[model samples]
Target: MTATAGAPAPSSTGQGGGPADDAGKESADTGPISAISPADSPVSPVSPASPTAARPLPPALPQTPTPSPEGSRPSRNAPVRLRALDGLRLLAALMVAAYHYGGRGGEISQAWGSSPREQFPTASTYFAYGCLGVQIFFVISGFVICMSGWGRPLRSFFASRVSRLYPAYWAAILIVTAVFALPWVAFKSVSPSDTLVNLTMLQQPIGVDRVLGVCWTLWAELRFYALFALFVVLPGANRQRVILFCAVWTLGAALADAANQPFLELVLMPQYAPYFIGGMGLYLIHRYGHDALAWGIVGLSFLIGQHYAVAELWHAPNPSFFSYRSTLGIVAIVAFGYLAVALIALGKFHWANWRWLTLAGALTYPFYLVHEHLGWVVVEVLHQKLNIPSYGTFALTILLMLFLAWLLYRFVEQRLTPVIKRSLTAVRVR
Candidate 1:
């Protein structure tokens, strides 16, 4: 049920595998003010999952300088980077990691030799809710994708995404596959054909199995990019057009849900659309300054998002069998996620502008990619074999995951992104 493969049913539930599970699974910009700066300009590279991008703002919309921990804001026309937002990405990644490491004991119970709840009764209860972190990531994607993709032709937008998403992802797929190949590792190996298909990140649509459980979200992200490129970027995205896109997407998703049309719901993403829509609304406010219209968009998204959040909890596999999730708690967690981003959009967390936070953000996508199954295997070796305490195993696994993330980013993503970008651009010219 969870995004992970071979994981126990109730113990693992968050992102779904393939199109059906990913359709509305938890997982977001604004407006027309002189083609606001694209987040993907040639400044510091931002992760595809990260919300902050650096580009000079359009001369039309100048921002007044404000005091903050990072010092006074740069002139409005200067490139904008929300370092705090980057840090938030790491937090979201960790929340999901916590869910797997501390919250669930299902498939992992084989290694733990007992239930995780028994091992960390107090912690499991809190970490169980971390699954909601997927929604937070989705919301942030909406904001960053909209910000980064603004003012670009469809080709340029696609190129930026390819460069950002594929570098780390490719590295992750090979790395995880190699680990799974080890004779000692218990996880099953993905077939060679499936591995090749996964490289395209289209395995879900074509009904091929995912190499990494967490990769299910990538399908959602890819759909979002395609839709945005076609509807928003191709026609020229601005405040009015984007707002219209949001409204239309919201309505279309609702209709799809009502009609019980699986294909429509898959495309429209009724469950997940609200968060993405709301994020775009927040970005509009961030870029163009707050207005009733943007606020209304966000409000509508929250209403719709809340409905799906609770519904996911209720409809979860055998809700009565091992139900530890509360509907109200789910709602509250989702609201907290929205509030955190809203504060960032409003520039209320200016104090979070630490430089190292950007590094933390950069690690998020790679961290999320490598964490789940790999971490589970590591936990098995550490606790089951080494006889380490549960908490100690958790701590060591997180540190190792972070190190792997850094390696993926520094050695793989950093080296490969520009290469991929150039390759794509070269092909385009021909």
Candidate 2:
């Protein structure tokens, strides 16, 4: 019965009806974004090359990542994998799922015949804060995008994103819509036209209702991709330019917030930009060495990010349900997110270097896409009609979601990514 905090609903309120609504700098130097291919940056983590070597900026990246003299720079050919990031990505997805399932409010009582807070008294306290996991995801995206896009061309970056996001997303929308269409199901169904719009991932901006509540996050991510492709990848990234991009975005977001400029706020995303920017700064440190400028960007981003996080807590739906929320708690959680990524940037989480972590990470996107709406149905059925215990229903729902996520990734994503990437790569500008 909990509402998804900060997730905009397609309709006024309630679960069945509709879906809810929902960085970095661097210098100039380097080849265009596509210069590096999969071959140039290998995925094998067992290589002798250090993690720093896996994503070196193009040669002649002055101030940020200039080429070292012979034998100085890490070998790019070996491409070290940051398996830890995959683990973190999965963790973020789980956090968001937990929040959506148990944290928002007592409306869940309608389904379970008991308030979530009562059924999950101890866990709901922490899960209440899980909505912030979206911010953590944005941060991770910033880091991963910057790392991957470095030295790659716009087409390649575009292809990778198209391949990675759309396949699982398309699958989720169709599957969820089909579930809603079931006559016996309690949730509301979308019209064919709305379902079509959801496929485009432009539902939020174009005023079309979304098929899923989580689609809002995809819209934000698409914007971030466009911004990065235009400003960083197209122009050719270097340390100096990347740094400047982060700084300017930070300033623009601040001004937009101060002036109450809707247009600027829409483009700048004042509330979420800090996490992305911070993530990019962390990537800079990961690829290059730690520097004052990179650390400064990260520091500033955390400060700005925490401020908005607190604001979001205050503005979140159902104020009465979240009366226990505090500014300190929000700030601490956001800070912890930054710290986790910073440790990754500094290569301090090597313990997460398991091969299975890659599969866990791959499951994240599909898991996230399918979890929310369908999950409620599963929770309701298992707990109510089936007469399962509350705890058993919760655990089963999570496991079922995870299994479905894996199936989507294995059957749909793996099959479609290459086709999509190839199709996108074939398109050329005049």
Candidate 3:
């Protein structure tokens, strides 16, 4: 999801209960809270059961509504916020940072006729694993956006999203530009026009890396948001209907990849679409109040796909076949996407919470934006000036980056968010 444009404002609490309470009541009012049985739900792609079906079906159990603590709200501190997600983001960021720094050492070592891996194993592994973080971020974005927008009006949903993401993002680009252009630093390659394009979030449209280099993910995310908005705008956009949309998108993406069609790749990449749908699906299950068993199934599906399944498929020798890659990857992506949704659905369940990690997760966007550049500078300076070992330097650089991220979150992002919100509000009124 996009970094919210405003300060970390708490979601508005509903009277006598919060959004959770309202959601719970709404779920009850809607109907039975059992898992959306493949046979019963129109959203499920399975064919209708025959009257002469071999075995008798078991009676559906009444879903026990998970009890939420009083006065709970979904925010940075929400108990349902998965700590694993934070850990995942941390892992991804470090991977990217290591990849960049490690590659630099690799370049130097090649010139010196030494094995780069021996000198910079940390960097090598990080480089290898860095792109995984981007995948994880895509999944997380899909899940969070889906959960946050579930049952909310499309207009308010879009507004809140724009409000939350743009402010900190714009501020970050400006800060980065200023730093890069400093007289002492003199890190100039980007022009003012380029900076403006990056700020407008259109860097990807013209086929150039944004000012930050890593901002390509933002383009993907924007596309997901636009698609999601379109899905909601279509007639009969309900939980079941959206699930079908996700299934179609997931399968279609796999098909496109198999056909080696570039235009289709833009739409069919599960990373581009399924994760968001999975997130939406999870939110529907949660919003409808499915039992723990259902949540378990979703989680299991996500883990199996993310860890064991996708790795095996992607690591295949000469595995350039689009169908193979797309099929496995899309399943994993959609699975994890749904798992994130499942977690959100059971937002009343408090098991996933970890305060510090949640805070780190909240800082992910800024950390992502700043870590590479700042961490690169730190690693270089330490290596060149102080002659630090690669691993030691890597560790130290990450710590320093994290510290700087904390300061940015506390001082700049935290402060400017509210001001941006107010300005947006005033503009809307006008």
Candidate 4:
């Protein structure tokens, strides 16, 4: 499907209504990311907006969107697909879940204790490598967000983003907080104020542990979103300007780390910025249409980084110094960024479209949110009651957590998302 200005082009295929005639009618333009209503339509054959005699230029499309930013833009000529991107998300989420489960059972520490001559591997050196998943998420978010906001007014872009992210997050926070309060109702002691800080998403600033341990990452993501919004709002801002800003931030983060300075932690966390910057860089590469080479590099880098770089750096006797592993981490970030760009350019990878995997990927966020706490409870119950082996107990706990998360996503998240979207859109309209 091809879109011109804010209008959709006439449909070439006879399957749908004529593009010219349909251009004048409003329909729902659903894609991977945010949906566009007729008024926000970009004037393409697939656009839901009514047709006019003169189509607007591509750069002058409507500002408001109908869909959320989590999806990609709608295509005017052909259907857009990005299965590889979903696969990437699934991989990242699984890594995080596995990391948590591995740590919970002391599996990683046990692996670390074993030697080459040991009978059984004690710990997996790759335990810390799981954090790289968050980096992948950052990269994907940066690229998709940049694309979503292209040629749109900054305020509208910000509004759309706030609508997409905040509602689900806030609802999650409330649910988690209520769970925390259940112990209080049973006469257990828990700090209400501390929980309140987490609900407000201010725990990180106050040096408090996230109410939901995994929420710290959400804080970082939000910070990047705010920064990107500012970049877009700034006059004459473009991809180059964004790149320059990211470069400066990366350098500052490195310098801060080198100096053991705490100041940069206030604005930019050194270890984290590389992931976000890597993502933004990937977006720039994709916008420029350099996707194929980017993917090859990303895949190669991910393999080498995970197998070699991570092992070397994480195992170093003195990891404080600039080392090969750190260099590889940087390389991995670049590679991951390229991979994301390539995935976007391809629109969809066939392998990622497997129904089971896609369903698993769709439940990822809820899984990430609920798995750890619920997993802990399951492990406790099994270890204390069933006396299962440590590994067996851990594995069972993960299974239970996954099951619970699936239920939560199916019953709660799935039901609430549409309502939240509608409510937010109504508010926006008001």
What's the TM-score of every candidate structure? 0.84, 0.84, 0.64, 0.63
Per-residue error (Å), model 4, residue 14: 52
Query: Per-model C-alpha lDDT, please?
Result: 0.65, 0.64, 0.43, 0.43
lDDT score at residue 389, model 1, on the 0-100 scale: 96
| Best of the two (3, 4) by TM-score | 3
Q: How many residue pairs clash per model?
A: 11, 22, 14, 42
What would you estimate as the lDDT of candidate 3?
A: 0.43
Sort every candidate by TM-score, greatest first: 1, 2, 3, 4
The residue ranges of model 4 lying beyond 4 angstroms of the native Cα positions read 1-79, 104-123, 166-190, 233-238, 251-263, 291-351, 388-392, 418-430
Tens digits of per-residue lDDT for model 3, 1-430: 1111111211110000000000010010000000011111111111111122121211111122222232222222111223444544454455545544453332223222344356564545434333334444444454445444444455544444454455445766887777667665423436777778777867756654356555555555566666766775333244545555666666676678579886777655443444344444455454444534334434543543354325333444442321123345435443543444344345432344455554555455555566655554565567656888766776787788777667656676556654553454454534
- How much is 373 displaced in model 2, in angstroms? 0.3
Q: What is the lDDT of residue 362 in candidate 1?
A: 66
lDDT of 4: 0.43
For model 4, give the 10-residue run with minimal summed lDDT.
Answer: 16-25
Give lDDT: candidate 2, residue 322: 47
Q: What is the C-alpha RMSD of each candidate to the true structure, in Å?
A: 7.2, 6.7, 13.7, 13.8
Better of 1 and 4 by TM-score: 1
lDDT of 1 at 157: 68
Instruction: Please give the distance, in angstroms, between residue 98's alpha carbon in candidate 1 and its true position after superposition.
Output: 0.8
Candidate 2 wrong stretches, greater than 4 Å: 1-78, 315-319, 427-430
RMSD of 3: 13.7
Preferred candidate (lDDT higher): 2 or 4? 2
By summed lDDT, the worst window of 10 consecutive residues in model 1 runs over 25-34
